[model samples]
Target: MDGLPMGRRAFSSTSPSFRATARVGVAATGVALALLLVVAASGCEPVPDGTPYDLVLAEGQVMDPESGLDAVRWVGIRDGRIATISQIPLAGADTLDAAGLVVGPGYIDLHAHGQDEENHRLFALNGVTTALEMEVGTAEVDEWYREREGQARLNHGVSVGHLGVRIAFYDDPSDFLPSGPGGYAVATDEELDTIRSHVRRGLEEGALGVGMGIQYTPGATRWEVLEVFREAATHQAPVFAHVRGFGVEEPGGSVEAFLEVMGAAALTGAPLHIAHLNSMSLEETPRTLQMFEEALERGLDISAEAYPYSAGLTSIQSALLDRYETAPDTALERLQWAATGEWLDRESFNRYREEGGAVVLHLNTPEMEALAIEHPFTAIASDGRIRDGVGHPRTAGTYARVLGHYVRERGKLSLMDALRKMALIPAERLQEWSPDFRDRGRVREGAWADLAVFDPETVEDRATYAEPALPAVGFHHVLVNGIPVVRDGGVVEGVAPGTGIRAGSWSPGS
Candidate 1:
């Protein structure tokens, strides 16, 4: 052990199992030893696999979510953190031949809804290692978080919904019915204070941020909202807003509602984020972006997120023409375009309609949909949901669809840009949670080795609204904390290697 590396080094006697796992090439052991020794002498930190290497993804189109690089490179992983990502022969481990694949920091989704295990499984198959669940409507959020732990394969995070907070902790229980009559009883300041207190407690307990379905609670006066957001802003948290109305339903469409969120930010001096812009921004994506750009220039902390699909999801109850305006079926049909009728499987819709929700689709313009994805400031989120025993297509198709349609076929965005939106932007937004997650949205020497490997040229999204359960094509390997979740297109099921991400900002009025 004299003059050895600070970390244990393989000397052919490290343990039969460890040796077997390394699978180091016989002839190059000397070269690997040399590189390991040099790195050790320079005080470089050790890799995950203490015995040297377990996996090395070699010579592939490496895409670092933060660096935004797509090139032929070798990424060596020991325990978990990528030890070396070099163009040279970064040795060790059983080689994962990614010669023609697109390698990326595992896709990160900042906005998503409830799609059950079936869809969660599909998400991993498609290479999304992390998903942030920002919907707060299901008031049973605390319990929801409890149930998902050690249960779902993908990494998950949650947000406290403003509307949910009001309904759950402050509202008179009986009044929590469907949106109707263009009005619902608004929460009084006394009631709002109680709800805000509940929200603050949830956020302090690691909830990501505030989620407001402003679309449902239009009666929530701006004053009450500013009170809530100002609280979030004190913690530098971003507020995710579900605008006052779906595009077609609103008098001025998506822009007016988005403008409302921005206006709130301006008034409250709080950061704001528009959720699922693809579904809501319709003919407004371009113009909305122009407004966003102005906000950015003015140094307003504002942004928007969207999924890759053109059709959006929601309850059939949301169709403005069907519920609010009573427009022609054709107009409602246009809005229905984006909603995934697949989940509404005639049976569930019938049940939900008979019992409560009337979930349906809202069709989106292909052009505007494309524009939303290509926008640099817009982060790519699945806005995915769990449904039935499976999940919505966004659970599985989002990242792959972006690669297939946006990067490969449509040429709407470069591979690098897409990866950044998937990982970096979401990661940046996640910083409000904790310092650990702050600078963690990248692929670097000391960063997490959570990785996704696919072939850009061959990567294709197989999940669709009609067939939302299809597994995506082209991910050959996926690693979470350096543990293999998916290896060669198959789930290594029984390993609970992922850790729950925790939120840290909590100083009351900070």
Candidate 2:
């Protein structure tokens, strides 16, 4: 490992992580030794008359990021929920041989942008069971939510872009329409009422909340954001923000500046999720972590996401990327399509900047890059945008790289710690918007059979900056709903009888 650092206790030096882990007794598996006791949660048992599950994943190695459990065990699954998890083996008609492999819940992606046919397969390849798109980039938020749910191989979730709601409602990117006591901006207060009605309608239509890209739309007023956040907060949905100045290096342009957006959430008591905080901080990695920590200490419910790749994927067409293009470094040179080996040259870059490629930025600091996984508020996201319709590395490389670099090679964090960020924490965060978020982040019996099996020693991310198309190695089996999607380094086509999941249509309080 070229850039491996110290304090990394989880890497397996002698063999694949799974083999090394297997040789050691339950006592020495690092944090992996602690999560063996996944007792049934209180008050979360089967209903009085509900039918039991269809399958059970018996004893192997169960890793629950929430409780930080990492040990060899057995799990029982019934009717798509976790039944019982213990060293005591229970009877089951079906079982999986997860011996010598890491078995944890499938990942919950907080801010994946693209959802294509191949990318769905690519996400399946990486063991991502649920993904929520924050910004409704190309499709209508209503249709996009229903569309992916209708066809995905993995369970999918969505956030209605405030930008989408704005554009869709206003249907015009014009100057001020009305705002003050007497003046109306979008139109009369009656029309403003109608727009607010539309935004609420999107939330009711199943958008998790709103996605705000403020820098991209400078014309959007703060009241506009507050207007919808109040509504989403009422519905118990958090606002997902791609805060104004992202991936920029200037005054008020860093990741820290985005905390102001987070502050707004805190002010209104709305849950806020910062989009790709890691992508914006290559040089100020320490400061960014501190800022997020301080906000958490302030009692703000804020979380963030990052991709494993130092570089992020987006088109140059983003309005915010254009404002920062005054420098040569910031100028779009060429965006090498990850899906295709072909290159979109500098000329194309400018054209796309105008036409909208929102070119992906490559993050290069080893420390800041490592922070993507090490930071507390941060979770893994691919920022995977749909290109004519193929997948990107983040879809295939994130978890594998989380294993290979942070835990296996670099030793920045423990394996269980990484799983917490990749699985449990994201699941908890999702729970704010979706009930399954709480249920899915662990490996108890009867939970969604979304599981990933891998040999720690050999499990490494193979995708590179140049070879971004290659899928990583080491995952032996991946199951969704008790159906094997990946078995022994091979993917089973058409077995993708996987269904989509919609969350929080029912409010606990309201």
Best by lDDT: 1
lDDT scores of the candidates, listed in order = 0.65, 0.62
CA RMSD per model (angstroms)? 8.6, 7.0
What's the lDDT of the predicted structure labeled candidate 2?
0.62
Q: Which portions of model 2 show Cα errors greater than 4 Å?
A: 1-10, 14-59, 88-91, 137-142, 148-150, 170-194, 247-252, 333-348, 354-358, 386-392, 507-510
Q: 312, model 2: CA deviation in Å?
A: 1.9
Tell me the tens digit of each residue's lDDT in model 1 across 415-483: 777778888888887775565565355777667777888766567888765666678887888877777
Report the alpha-carbon TM-score of model 1 versus the true structure.
Answer: 0.81
Provide the TM-score for each candidate, comma-separated: 0.81, 0.81
